[model samples]
Target: MGVVEALVGATVFDGETRRHGVAVLVTDGRIAAVLPEHAVPAGAVVTDLGGGLLTAGFIDAQVNGGGGVMLNDGPTADAMAAIARAHRPYGTTALLPTLITDTPAATAAAIAAAIEAAPTRPGVIGLHLEGPHLAPARRGAHVAELMRPLTEADADQLVAATEAIGVLMVTVAVEQAPPRLIRRLADGGVVVSLGHTDATYDDVVRAVDAGARGATHLFNAMSPLGHRAPGMAGAALDAGSLWCGLIADGHHVHPATLGIAIRGKRGPGRCFLVTDAMSTVGTEGTTFLLNGRTARRENGRLTLDDGTLAGADIDMAASVRLLVERVGVDADEALRMASAWPADYLGIAEMRGRIRAGLQADLVHLSDRLEVKATWIAGERDEA
Candidate 1:
């Protein structure tokens, strides 16, 4: 009925596994079918990729900045559009424009920007509020002065805001915000995540009970797992109900450590990848401001003058490459970590994360070397 196109000749990673000599049909900006190459319908337009890897486009839930624009700099629709354009080249079809620790007024501005941008910006799914309600001691690049406990009024505002913005993910320290607030946020359709905390195992469990379903940049800003104490990191790995977002830039986490987290994490709750990218992601710029302090990008790492690690400087494609080449992750599973897992965590898998029928036709074609050759966002192809 609608205009139909077939993509053939690639090893298709259908979000969960790989299939060979397959063809995917796109109609009206959604996948119509995935079948063998020979099964393509008559008169269907076809594009043969010549034997490379085809998979769902990367979905990053944590993106601080890109395209020379940081959310902290503008927190406007224009800034969100710029960030989306910057990451598109690297195969990220959808992302959450993250706002790190900032003032309450700044937070409100960011939410307003996201609400204004979401309808027009196809790539921005929602907003990731990463702080302002974090533990001061673990606030890596956040301004300690700005970090505070979550008040009832703040909780009500966040809940109300989610009605306008589709997904409002707030990263809070459970040690600071009580279980009741976590429950309130979850009840209000906010995706509550735990991060930047010094909470022990019990605290994390209590947060989980209150519907905190994810961990922010696990093992980086949170308390480490102790053999005797079992902190938030331990709970993250042990909890089968939580999804942990890992920064696989090979800088925030060691290769061996990442491998362990990947293997140790149980099902229904897996470790997925996030770029945690900064302003240097798609631009040649090497430095940016984080909470008014200079965050310089050198040697593939972003850090403050005092060597405190800020957001990462990697992109989604690079994160996938690092996971496969350095961390010894299976290519298929690594791809899932970048796309499907994150989509599932964000509760958008049915539409955006996979190459199955009825899903939006968001996909990427990568060469044997894992370089992005082209990307299709909602069935519109952009060739590199």
Candidate 2:
């Protein structure tokens, strides 16, 4: 009943299979149909994509900042919008504006911001609170002093946050957030992910049993996979229900290690790519402040003065390309990792993650070589 538009001239991957000679029809901000090119409605407005690949847009679950804005510095709706806008050019049509470990006041502000922006910002889906509750030993770039045990009041606030934000992902360490608390958060509809942890296999098992559905940036800040210990990384790989986020940027993870993890990972809960990006992304800035510490960008890597990896400088398109070209994953599967898998991890698969009829028309136009050319969020082309 609304204005209809047909996106044509590109090979379309509907998050499952690729098809040629088809047009994706959009109406009322949702996908109306995916039909043969010649069958487009007579009155529909048609936009040619110029012979690239049209697929579901990338959905990043962990995004710290972009467009020279850090969520921690200003946890506001505008900041969330800016971050989203920056990534849109790189094919990320949906993302969680993530907050690194910070004060309780900052955390509250981020929740409020997400609540306000979730409805207005098409690209911002929710908020990812990466921690104030984490183990000090594995606290990569997070201020160790700020890391503490999850309090009762904190749990209550987080549960209340889920009601408004709809998808609040909280990363915690088992040592900081107990299994009982994990269950409480899960019951409150909070997506609990284990991260910045030094937990052994048994510890991770308990957390997984308590409904911790994911692992954040697998194998980077967590315990390594030792033959005798079988730490969080091992448990993450062994557990079929735990979806893990892998930072495919070569600096964060080695290609050989990534290859091994991808091949060895089990079913139902696949290993997906996450940027774990920072403020420097989509900008030419050389450095930024993280928890009052300076993180410099050099040689395609972001690192603190002391040489600890802060956050990635890569974008979603580059991540997918790395997975396929360097890590040896199938191109389709790599794209799924950036789009479908993360949407599934956030429990929004039905609403997004695919180019199916009835889903939101969030799509990306990428060249055959995997460079992003344009993006569409909710059926509107992002000219930014």
Candidate 3:
């Protein structure tokens, strides 16, 4: 490969709601310049994309597993690889391996495995432990038997491992997860998200007040925003400043509800997309393995045999497509939910999220019909 590749005629987006004519210059795996079409760098090996739609590399903040490999399956490298290859094709260039509520030993093993795998697999940004430190009252699919208090030792261990991880996200309830533990995790550079809780408005405020950064799978695992109660979801929406992730598969959250969030959290940094998919994503069949239990995917949704909603069968790229097709949203605005927003939420805003100068040349090229034609991860372009 050349030192730089000038992508000519491609309409590049900065992972924000702005579209313009630009030729991207990538060098050493970073965006060196976003030049006007007329200003292609001399001898830059110009690649005329025929004006394909170029957006930032997709980020799925909440990915369970894909490719028939569950990351929660003992945190082994094979499991992580299964998770990576599963989403990589559907335009998920980066992701967080989500582990559900489990025993302390299991949680620790997951963390260690995530840390070990993250470095080798750059697309695996970090680990998202969705439970063990959550509210049982709102535990949607997590095993209730394994839920527990937010122990300091657990926080310390996750933090210590994060010294090696680029990011670490934990979904917890302010009422269930200890306050100081959340604060400490945030202070130590771990991203704290509130979810699976029946927290009151004040409780939501306190979590944010205590330095929680975002909400995981908004409107699915948290309390609804009832006018009379306006509980945790209400507080999150009302706060109006925190970053929230929505599973916009049109299954987990309705387009109308997503529209309401789009209006409510409209100011600066508000909402994004996450595919809370379990292990069955990107597979041809319906059955999957979750916590070693039989899981099923029916009608584009994943559920336990008892018809309990486990997670999702959607990927982040498909989520963007759903937003455009279902919500009638602007493509740029909708794309932010998967790329820029999640990057900023993880505190890797400078590098991972946007298609701009000096940012990583991680991007996706799609056809007019929104089909992902190619995905570039760490500068290695994969056309599929």
Candidate 4:
């Protein structure tokens, strides 16, 4: 048997439900078991979490930048590692280093960096290319000039990327990427998502039929849910197979609006929280560059000079807290949105999203108030 350690003194939520007086056993960087505290095996090392809640670490799929490093600014393995480190303190154990609306060459560089980093960087799971193939009408902070239709060559490149990285997610407008192309990418193992579009309800349904798995930051860059015209937002809420990424920063979406969406969201694919964080997270910097334009961070919002929202100024822990406190979400469900739901959306739930036996020992310990006190990735404590 490998070296065994028992984590105790906290209420445990094993992704599905909560249990008290249980000790989580870790061996060889995987969960060994979750049994009663007194049932801990003989000679196993013990560490008390000091009265808190232990749950699976948060998994974010829409992280743009962190640790003063933007993936677009530095599409290298080191930058990806830096971004992961920046978010770890905030309870994010794994994240996709997102590249937003950059050139084709830049996208290639980001993919190469992700392939290079995935083996060594446990936190950098994959890459999220969130544009250049999006609609100019809803280009929030993306360079409109760089936005273009998805070509066969672009589709080929994205499909090829899926073979190299653990996950390759591409966000495109339905108008630019037709159902056929979406089907091709999905068949090639890419997690196709809809965003930055003026697409109609029919457009979204066609994409979903073509295997588009999710909506990027629902109701922000996509078309709104109108009573007469049910746009992408309407389709997202109505579609049972599509996971919606919610930016619960209280700026991109209102608390009440998020509450209603949470309550009305369809099944099999619920709304999950994503940070959409920028380089300002875990830093004191008040401003950063988004495609060469200045994005100012003030009043808990990140926006361009023209007042266009750039990305989010929040972290995963704060996002969960916002949903629970402001949006009136149950604490357990909000925690699921931050961890389990995103892991399921990324198809990585079998690996690290839960505290079940045989899963990776990725965990976060939070105070009764939901603030992160410490985190463990692969059974190792994050001292940074």
* lDDT top scorer: 2
Say what the RMSD of model 2 is.
0.9
Collision count for each candidate, in order? 0, 0, 2, 0
For all candidates in order, the CA lDDT equals 0.92, 0.94, 0.81, 0.93
Residues 188-236, candidate 4: write the lDDT tens digits: 9999999999999998999999999999999998899999888999999
lDDT of 3 by residue, 1-384 (tens): 457788867677777545577788888888888878788866787788786688898888888888877766767755776787778877888888988888788777887777788888857878888988888788787887788888878788878877786778988877777677888998888899999988888888888878888888888877888879988778777775568889887878889999888778834657888899877777787787776678787788878777778888888778888889988878888878788888878888888889888888888888877778888888888885
Error of 2 at 200 (Å): 0.8
Per-prediction TM-score: 0.98, 0.99, 0.95, 0.99
- Candidate 2 per-residue lDDT over residues 4-59, each given as its tens digit: 99999999999999999999999999999999999998999999888989999999
For candidate 3, the lDDT comes to: 0.81
In model 3, state the lDDT of residue 276: 90
Residue by residue across 13-61, what tens digits does model 1's lDDT show? 9987789988999999899999999999999999999988999999999
TM-score of 2: 0.99
